[model samples]
Target: MRPALHAEEDVLLVVDPQPTFMALCPDELPVPGAEAVIPVINRILAGPIARAVVTQDWHHPRHLSFASQHPGKRPLETVDLPYGTQVLWPDHGVRATPGAAIHPALDQAKVVMILRKGFRQAIDSYSGFRENDRQTGTGLAEWLRAVGARRLFIAGITRPYCVDWTAEDAAAARFETWVVEDACARLGPDDALDASRARLEAQGIRFTTADTLHGENA
Candidate 1:
């Protein structure tokens, strides 16, 4: 018998797992066991999960999110923007760049939708629903609402940034949100991870693991 699904009212939201985002950075601490999470996501995608959605960071060559655009600036440096503080990324991940392409593990046939964000040069998008500042739009919220999704199960790369941001927003949107801890990785500081988790929890977002998605505890 299949183990109990950890959640019944959840839609899996896979954040940026593109090749560009997964390459190890020089200054950031590697996300603990993030590599192992890929297969887990694939398994969940193919499993009986209620639904699965993925996001791709599709940036223009001159995207403002890139440190390269702001010469002399470095990655992780926060700059004030119309939305708030924006984190400048070094010459690391560039979506659709051969290296930043989507992970092959995703079975597109199984995904209900693929939301592409960060296409604007001035706007840096992290969440699948809304851009930073909660003002910019992506139509993901409408899509989820149309699909009748009341809960979100989030996973994928860079736990502290993209995944964290998505989960926090989902909760703020009043959607039951959970971050599959084992299904994501982070390159931010340890403190950043803790802070991210704390903030999300404060918003009532649940933190879980892939084991919760499988049999019995599923």
Candidate 2:
């Protein structure tokens, strides 16, 4: 049987549903099929879930994660950073740009808070809870705790990175975390997504489809 999400005890987390991350737009880094997930996310938001939070990949024009900043290196190349293996990407999610804005299809009015991350010029932020440095937290966990959110339901663009990292961190923070699989798009290879699923499963994070939730809650 699927668990029911109580409004007061559960919070819906939308991770980086921005134009910069969607293939539907000609943004610097668009994830394939990212546009398709917006409707799925909206369906979840319109369901029984009440409170919600959204994360934005708000980066600086000269952010360290951009490949253009490093001469001779193109986007999608892997470079070792002080943190670990970092995938160099095109400059994206620059603050004040249209690409940084949330997808127009998303119901932003329903979100209680908008958490802007990756604004640090020197670091990259994948997890809504923390920077890639793994120590610099965005205080998402604290906010969730303060709001009395005991469980977290996550949905968004790019499954292998942001969504995966957020679920891992949320579980580590002692919240019952569940990822709505169909509500997310993968930016990496299938193997990467498979590995991420394994990692999340090991941490006890649950996975479900939007249809399952809608059927149970209906």
Candidate 3:
């Protein structure tokens, strides 16, 4: 028998599934497994999860966050911005681009809300709730609170970056958070996934599977 479903206050958060992120080099550090997670994400959305939210990494072409825009650094190189440590990225998706939009995995009509972040040219946003600095806001927390989302199951592109950040921040914000382990994939070696999971578990994020989450009601 499947495990019982959590209460209705829980939610499923799908982090950046944008085109640029999805097309990332499979051998890159964070491992963009956008396609791999689709089926798992779809099942969760198709299940009894009370709320579903997604975050998009929308950016501008000349966005200051890009390492190429800086001229002196390479992507993945860290630089100190006024906000703090920022990961310089290769130019990704623009808000207007269809690739940056949410994948067709979930029924759009079923999601309660879609939260987008990283519009600013100067900052990099890895977490759905906040940017890397932890000061600048995405306003996701307020929105989640308004919707009464206390439990979060997170999955999406680049397991080591945005997905990891979102789950950590959600747990830190006092939400009961879980990362669907098998639903996600990574670009780095096994070490990266292990380390990321360790940090999340330390912060109180539970490690789970979409199968279990979806079959809980079976």
What would the TM-scores of all predictions be? Answer: 0.86, 0.96, 0.89
Q: What clash pairs does model 3 have?
A: 19-99, 31-187
Q: Best candidate per lDDT, number?
A: 2
Clash count list over all predictions: 9, 0, 2
Model 2 per-residue lDDT tens digits across residues 1-218:
47787878878899999988766556588887888988898887778888889999999899989998889999989788888888889888999899999888898766998999999998899999989989999999999899899999899967888999999999988999999999988877789899999999999999998877666662
Show model 2 residue runs off by greater than 4 Å. none
Of 1 and 2, the candidate ahead on lDDT is 2
lDDT of 3 by residue, 165-191 (tens): 888888878888888877665656789
Candidate 1 deviation (Cα RMSD): 3.4
User: What is candidate 3's TM-score against the reference?
Assistant: 0.89
Estimate, for each residue in 50-108, the C-alpha lDDT of model 1 and write its tens digit: 67888888888787877777767887787788888898875544555665566676666
Name the regions of candidate 3 deviating beyond 4 angstroms. 1-3, 24-32
Check candidate 1 and list the clashing pairs. 3-215, 3-216, 4-215, 4-216, 4-218, 5-218, 6-218, 20-99, 20-100
For candidate 1, the clash count comes to: 9
Which residue pairs of candidate 2 clash? none
Rank the candidate models, highest TM-score first: 2, 3, 1
